[model samples]
Structures are given as structure tokens and as C-alpha cells.
Target: MKITVLIENTKGELEDLINEHGLSLYIEKGNKRILFDTGKTNNFIVNAQKLGINLENIDVVVLSHGHADHGGGLLSFLKINNRAKIYMKRKVFGDYYSGNILFKKSIGINKEVFEKYSSRIEYIDNFTEIMEDVFIITDIQRNHKVPEGNKYLFVKEGTKIVNDKFEHELIMVIKENKGICMFSGCSHNGAVNMIEAVNKLFPGTSIKALIGGFHLAKIPAIDIFSTSQDEIDLIINKIVNEKIEKVYTGHCTGEKAYNKLKQGLGNKIEYIRTGSEVQI
Candidate 1:
């Protein structure tokens, strides 16, 4: 399977393409094309065009979670390819704010687009398979020491603002010849948990690659908090000890956090830019 990044926070030599605090990936496994998540705005489309990727060829669209940065572009994507089935967890809706009480930001998907595309959605709370070995994994149990939860990310329940349980989060796990590659949309539930989820689903399966947001990288320019160094070390240690071969991280993964991992993992860890591609 090969994955192409259509949208992300960083842009490389293709500086002409737009950038945003979002994530979108195009996965090609066999003849089936899958769109992982549509980034914020229409930047995914622009980057895909520049990368010579035809968005209309996508056969299935999978949302890792409900957050706006991940789910926001689906509306525009449907305009281009409306036939692809959207697979996601049920809780990916409603008002989600991710900032301090003084400055709350709407982080959920646009209600208008969600309503319009409701007919195309496939809510999968349990294990789901797109084709043969390509799967959507959910119900992760975070067992490692990371941020317990994001204090800034919350959900509104009537008049009460409560912490989001993140049931909406789902991961993509593709079985390869050597092992499996796990794709966590945001890792909001924690990377360790995501790995654990994979392990639990398919016992003794080796993890070949880990791609997508680590949620430890700090993006100061956008005011997103970074995970503590101690926690970052734990995460890196887990990845190394588990023997994950490749890691391509960005978006909310934070620049500093990624560099820190690079120091320990060397070439095994790398940042994936907007037009980058990874084959496994």
C-alpha cells in the first residue's frame, strides 16, 4: 500500500500549494483508492491537483475523527467525488470547542455539510473492513503515560461543558506482507492506545509503520499546546521498543516533538509534507 499526503500543515518545494492546520491522505491499495481525511478548507483539492492525484477516483472516504481540521473538507470533496462511501464513528458530530474557556474555537465539522452528506455516511463503531485487510479500528484503550486528556478540548451537553471521550476517533490499519501500518487521524486518544488497539484486534501483528498526528508536536504559532518532554520520551520509547519501521508525522504532531523523536529514532522518523508519498 502507498499513501500520499494531499493536505497538511507544512509545504515543501511545492510552496505554491496552500497550507493549513489540517490533515488529508490519499491511500492506494490495489485498485481501490481511499481518502483518509479531508483537511481544512479546499487545500486538499489544490494539493492533490498539484500532485497529479485525481480526487474523483477515490472509492472510499474514511474519517479518523469528527474534528474540523480532519473532517472540514468533506463537503468540498463531495462536490468532486460524491460517490465514495464515508466511514466514521457515530460520535463525530456536535459542538466541539478546543481552546481555553476565554477563547473557545469551533473544532467540529461544518453542520451544513454534515447534514447534506448524511446520506452517504456509514457509522461504524465496531471493527470495519473496507476491502480485504484494510480496516477501520476503534475503541482504543490508552495504556501508556501521555496527556490524560486535552483540557482545552471539550463538548457541550445542554448547558454543561464536558470533556470529550473521543469515541468518535477511529484508526486505519492495513495488513501488509511484513506487518501492518497504522494510521491515526489525530492520535487525540493517544498513540500508545492506537497501537494497543491494533494489537488487541489482530494479536501478534507487527507494526510496520505509524503515520499521522502524534499530538505531541507543539505548534506555537497556532497556540496548540505541546506534550511534556517526559511524556514525549515515553511515546518515543514505546515506538522504538515496539520496532515500528517507519513514522511519518505532522499536522498536530508539533515540529519540536517530531525533532525530538528524530534524535532517538534517526531515519526511522520523518515529517510528511503536503505533497509527500509513503509506500509500505
Candidate 2:
């Protein structure tokens, strides 16, 4: 199988273009072509053109979550590949935010974009199979002891907190000739949690590689006892415990957290830049 990071939060090469906070990847194996996430802007399509990736040829499109960084480009992609079936949870269309700033400014899926492609949408609340080897992990409730990050995540019915589990965010699992490759976008449910779920689903199948946003961007709090690095140290510890072979992470996985994880995971980890390809 082949994986290409068409768009990510940062640009590694000087010539690589940087789109605003998004992660889009191209995965191809055999006759199947999969577009993991669409990113926050139409730039994913533009950059994909530069990489010679024909959006029109995609057989399946997976939205990792509702975040703009991940799913905002759906409308543009749909225009190119209107025939492609989209796999995403229904709650992805619900409102999302990032504390003080609305998620549109931070990251969110605009209703107009989704409505435009409503005809091709496939809402998956539980595990959904695209092909015999490709799977989408849904019904992912946070099962670990990790902090839910903050109190910001919620469904607001006109500014009132409504009970919502944010069950929409999903992880993509690909079982190829090499092994299982996990593609995730902003794992607010916890990166370790996502990996563990994959292991449980495919018992004894080693994770060939893991890619996309892990969402470890915890900035410092006012006069907090520890720096954001401390929090990240714990997160890295969890990833290390998983024994994943290779990781290509960026976007919401913040530079600070990436650096911390790099120090711990060393060469086992790598940054997934805007335009790079990894073969598995």
C-alpha cells in the first residue's frame, strides 16, 4: 500500500504550501483509492493536483472527524469526485467549537459544505467497511483514563450544554499486504485509545504504521503548575506503550508535543509534511 500526506498542519519543504490547519492523505492499494481527510481548505485539491493524485478516481472518501481542519474541504472534493461514496459519522454535521473561538475559526465542518454533498454521504455510527480490507472505526467512546482535554467540547443548544458524546470522530484502518495502517485525524478521543481500539478489532495484527493528527496541542494555562510539555510527556508515554512502529504526525499534534514525542519515540516517529509519500 502507498500513503501520501497531501496536506498537513505544517510544510516541511521550503516549496511545500501550507494550508490552514488541516490533514489530508492519499492511500492506494491494489485497485482501491482512498482519500482519508479533506482538510480545512480547498487547497487539498490544489496540492493534490500537484502530486498527480486524481481526486476523481477516489473510490472511497473518509472523514476522520467533523473538525474543519479535517473535513472542511468535502464540498470541493465532492465536486471533483461526486461519484465517490463518503464515510463519516452523522454527528460530524453538528456544531463544534474551540473554547472562546468558534470552531470555524479554529476547525469545523461547515453545514453548507456537507449539504452540498448530502447525496453521497454515508453516515457510519458503528464500524463500516469500505472494502474487505478497509474499515472505519466508529462508536468510539473515550475508554481510557486520559483527560477529555477540557470542558470545551459539547453540543450547545443555543448556548446550553446538551448531552452529546461527540461519537462522530472516527479512525480509518487499512489491512494491506504489509499489515494494518491506522489513519486518524485529531484524535481527541486519545491517540492511544485509537490504537488500542484497532488492536482489539484486528487481534495480533501488528500496526504497520500510524499517521495523521493526534491533537496533543495543550498550551500552558495561566500559572499552571507544569508546562504543556509535562502534559505531552504523559501523552508520549502512552504512545510509547503502544509499541507502534512508525508514526507520521502533525497538525493538531502541536510542535511542542511533536518534539516531546520525537525525543521519546526517536526515529520511530516522523512528521507528515504537506507533500510527502510513505510506502508500506
In candidate 1, which residue pairs get closer than 3 Å at backbone N, Cα or C atoms, i.e. clash? 217-253, 217-254, 218-254
TM for every model, in the order presented, reads 0.95, 0.87
Candidate with maximal TM-score? 1
Evaluated with lDDT, which candidate comes out highest?
Answer: 1
Q: Give lDDT per model, in order.
A: 0.83, 0.75
User: What's model 2's lDDT at 39?
Assistant: 81
Model 2 off-target regions past 4 Å? 14-16, 101-107, 145-150, 158-164, 219-238
lDDT string, candidate 1, 1-280, tens digits = 8898888888766778788889999999888898999998888998889888999989999999888889989889998996899998888877887777677777889888668878988888788887788899877886765454366688887998777777788999888888998998778888887878888997888899999987774442363556777777777888988888888898887777778778888998989988888888
Residue 223 in model 1: shift from native, Å? 6.6
What is the RMSD, in Å, between candidate 2 and the native fold over all Cα? Answer: 3.5
